[model samples]
Target: MPELEVSYKTTSKQFLGRVTTSKESADFIRGLFNEGEIELQEQFIVLYLNQANKIIGYYKHSKGSINATVADIRIVLGTALKCLATSIVVSHNHPSGNLHPSAADKVLTENLKQSAALMNIKLLDHVIITKDGQTSFADEGLLGIKTYDQHTAFVQKVTEALEQKTKHNKLSLEKLAQTFGITDKTEVKELTELAIIKTARILAHSAGNVKERFDKIVELYHAQVNLSHRTSQSILLQQYSTPAPIGYLAGIFCEVDKLKEKGGYAFEPSAGNGLLTIAGEPERFYVNELDNFRNQNLKTQGFANVWNRDATQAFFDVQGNFNAVITNPPFGTAEKKVMYDTYSIKPLEHVMALRALDCMAQDGKAAIIIGGHTNWDDKGRIQAGKNRIFFNYLYSRYHVCDVININGAKLYSRQGTSFDVRLILINGRKLKPEGAASLFNPLKDVEVKTFDELFNRVMDAMDAVTNNTFMKPTNTLEREAIELQKLFTTTELISRFDNPPPQEGLGEALNPPYQPACESSVVLNTQVPDSMAFETRTAIQSIKEAVGGDIDNFVRHRLKYPNK
Candidate 1:
């Protein structure tokens, strides 16, 4: 019997119609043969399809010859049973250049066809693929009419696999940490295989190359770990100081570093881990450090004369001025940081406010990273509206930029450092609100070659998001609560004609006089993407995956509307 030349032929029914639709099926088939054996004949394929005839699985089984014609049904269908294949397509390759089907190949197909039918399993297609192309005995009228539909629909196998993997972006650190008994998000001092595997699976689903995704996951993890330790802890825990939010701090520092490189003086008051004190920061800026150990660390790192004085008094006695002073000032009051009374052990607000003022020269610029918790008061209004008060205090002489939400962390979480941070740039010389607008530019392009710049940019974006005024949840959030009586204005419909549905249902229920509530509902993805949308579908997907489903819908939804 002459070796049957392999042919391109697949039917809708075989592989549950999945193989027929696959564009990369040819490559996948090639890979299957190459999996173990040295050549093509060593492997055969069994494509599994669902009830709907869509391929749910594409399986590779058994080794035969290296050259032409190397597979059998017994090797293929038997493996399909293990995966619970509803229907299967069995295919073999002929390494020989010619694709003529042999009498033996005919006899073998017949036997498998009869047996599969008897076993209540459908024999959808018998495809023969060769070096040049494929052939279907069924199409040539060599196969009986019954198997015609089965042989014509095989899709591209590799395409299906790639698409399935990339369809949903996912992450693995959470799964591995749970599996390894590493409960704390911060305690992960080292990474394990499971974590790496999880990362691979996740990155396999992103917009960029696989390498970029893995790098990002690692960077995001390192960042979150650094942020997780930054706050209130049990006394014993507090004994060891908390680390700064690594990702956010580094980014803020980089900007100051850039300014310094250009010959501007930069100063840091609370430099932890010196996340921002890079080689590029200004040459003559002063850093007032209260911690003796950290100060020494800086000094050793060439930060000359790291002052071991309180920042409050240090600033009061400062002799020279800085071109820029950027810092992540401590926010909460409970911790016994180097504190001084402005009028009385100063408010955390007053501390940051004063730090900004003191740090600036007449024409100097300052950027500060402040915790949003400090943005409002106990009443849930912007703490004392101090965001404004601080702005006004600084604005008297300097122009204020919009608060930049760095990486989107409202508060550092024990779960991870992959949150947001906001940086507000205030120019020293008094000017209009728009004067510092350029500092708050949203990155239009992403070039993430090294993990550093990419990591910093992502954090910077998060910062912009967190500090966005739209964060307050409503246009008139401060307008006053919607009184029950205000549902219908007094002059118009008093006894009430139909008002809108509940705001909760506003998302699903809104009919278009208004479009679908894409703007109002922050968590839901836009059903139809628009050109103007700030958040890309991939980015939104990334956000959902990063925060887990734990973050509130507001955070999720607002993320989609980056403009807000």
Candidate 2:
């Protein structure tokens, strides 16, 4: 048998050495993609680099339709091993010319990074190339990709170390953390180990010794830590409080203007830092806040009627009712009940809605921001099915007008947070209307951008979706309910209650009309989440224990034997 020798080759004569900058690396990748026919179809390629980042070669991993391309993990890593490269850069072109990485693209980059790390190969960056420009994963700090630092001192140290020859020892995590003020021990330790291991492998592939690689590794950790710090700085100043975006406030006010009576006092129950307070009519605005810092901040800012109290307490303490009430109240079960109990409804925003009605003057108007799922059933039905009861209750009580839905992320997202589900903005008059509640809407003429644009877009979306009633049911709840009903009806104990027995050997039969033991219909109609139901049942159990009898059994027995 003849033996076949495996050999590696460099396909390109262009010796692009030392991938210094993201722009430079991006340009090289762009050039590689440009070599082929630039068409609408997406093509994925991986650039294999040596310790110095000189062009070792590249492999075209996958080519697919205009909208999709596949970069198999096995092939990507296999190509790197074949080339014997120390580092790699994965890239793909978008015919759509959109540079923003889709969620799928981000996931792919993450997978590639983890898979490559196991093989001791550093994935430097994942670049998305378009005709206009490139979006570098390293630049955006996506998937923990390190953005290289070109500090003169660090560069000099690396250059000097490379000129010498010595085995280098890795730096300790504690030393790196202390030097950089990194409190995230876990992240720092992970990066420290990864950088050290990758640097050693890279040095083995080039003229650079372990000592030179160690210097580069230290520099890498510093850049990564600095990037994390910078990202932290971009967070909203009051993220802990979930400060509403300015655009949302603007949109609310634009719609509020239609209902606000001139010279009427405006009140914000859960005011934080007086954002909504300042947004309202200056002379007529009043605020109440429980947060000490925010309350002090409002007072320091010279707000005239800033009450340092719980909103529900303020509702009782204040002398006169407000003409216009608006707020995005906090949402927590404990604090919500503490502010004002809404029986089993634990969401603070819902209690706020009820409180607003109580505190507002006759014929007064109110606008409130609430959680989106308030009117959603377990089946994912919106404004109908089980949730219909909740809306019906609202319609019957207040002159419910409009319900605007917006992404809750916008409120706290200046800090780079994003929520998948939308929140709700409810507007209404305290007085009952003559006919059906006419849901109000925001106008579509305005342009929303940046932090401010989110609110207007929310308003626009709410307005647009008003006529698109009936959210498709996920059917999860329907299936759950049917199963539950079957379980309840067929259970041995429940079956005993269904067919009541003769009363204690007295020969008299006892029978009563069947009444559900726990008001299951009411619970479902209101769309109570499972947690709330559990808490309520626990409370009921406690009461039953205190009374020294099983309440559920009594109710069941009573329902069947009322005529005993």
Candidate 3:
């Protein structure tokens, strides 16, 4: 056991060494050089290990600055195989007496942690050696580790970038930082640079004035807005975040012709920019968004009916009837309630607290954006799979119509998310079990049995189910769709964990685990999914993995096709 423990420690040490040392180890090593006499520049070396602590051939392959070196993830670890090192140690010399790590040094170490994680290598320690003694990052509890401070900082940076996404409308960097609770001007400048390019791309596509930029920014910002009135003034300020692609709001005008056929009712429980309202859904629409900034913009745009109110309380406050309910509800939690970055780190109750209009008229048609995993349910505890099932169950009752799947993942490649948007159409009329109930049902022309038959099936079902019966027994179709939806809610995954990442995108974490799957194997151990149903799930997973939760990609792709 002692030998095993020692071996483990050695491997951990070597793994961390490679991470902090260099990302790649392709070139030959630089001779220990003298930088201004006392300043020694030593490359951070990764010691790859086998079973225990053992000597391995070093990848002396970095020739760069005086502080740190980068190695290719594959090459750095590959050295371990060649040297047959059971465990490795990372050692670096500080030419100067200063053993403290620089900001760059810390960042590189974290990036290495992320990479080592992907490679399944253990990160042990990062020792900063001076002429006198060695200072270990692991000993300091900094090896392959990051404090909550860094994570919040990262979220703030990303948030700043999202705010900048609307800067084309001329939102000053300083203003955005303050909204996010950053009082330091230095942080504002730092964050602007991070997202300026992406923001420019978004702005370049828009044709708007300075005021308009602020207006557009409100949508992005309000997505993360803190709505509580009793909250601290600091926390109450609107938290600007990145607005997803406008493609995310596709089909806002969908079934408009049909919606007009009935006495019109339009409601947006969480209207950000009143995107749906502006798209011309209802003549006198009612919008309930907590962010005053956005609501004011809507009111300025002649949406006087808009109000700054909590959406969850819509049931109690709004007494008006509705013909259509359209919105892209914040698919995740509200900023004031819980903290989240790109992906939800932990399963917080806030996720369940933010459901779309449960009060939609049974016969009203509704559109809402949701995460791919929104349907889960943990024993009515609210999970993605279970939510979808419950949503289906709710719609199956009277007043709910068809649920339309909005394919939004095929376009955006930002994060790997299975989340997408869908439209749930309900009319005031109760849908019968057997009489062409599906047309009244919403999912038509949305989800697919096979990618090839996607739209055709939607149209045919809508066409064929015109005379459905309400009491028709649940059959194979309902069972199959419900089963797939359940996967999003039932299957468990790592809600949160920590690791370092590459400075450039796609950095790995030290031994960071893969996302838990409904049926997961490190290697593709299961037989290939060959059936149309299985293939459909596979296609969905492929799209989800490519973009995480951003749904604009799929929306853009589907829009390219002619209206079905």
Local accuracy of candidate 2 as per-residue lDDT tens digits, 489-563: 443424423343322432212111223235323423233433133234446556667655456556667688553
Better lDDT candidate (1, 3) = 1
Task: Report the error of model 3 at residue 60, Å.
Answer: 86
> Which residue pairs in candidate 2 collide?
401-439, 402-440, 448-453, 449-453
Task: Kindly list the per-residue Cα lDDT of model 3 for residues 443-481, writing each as its tens digit.
Answer: 333353222243333334344345453224554244333
lDDT of 1: 0.44
Mark the regions of model 3 whose C-alpha exceeds 4 Å error after superposition.
1-254, 257-263, 317-320, 333-358, 374-389, 398-564
- Candidate 3 to native Cα RMSD, angstroms: 29.0
Report the poorest 10 consecutive residues by lDDT, candidate 2. 505-514
| Least well predicted 10-residue stretch by lDDT in candidate 1 | 433-442
Better of 1 and 2 by lDDT: 2
Error of 2 at 254 (Å): 7.1
Better of 1 and 3 by TM-score: 1
Which candidate leads the pack in lDDT? Answer: 2
lDDT of 3 at 450: 28
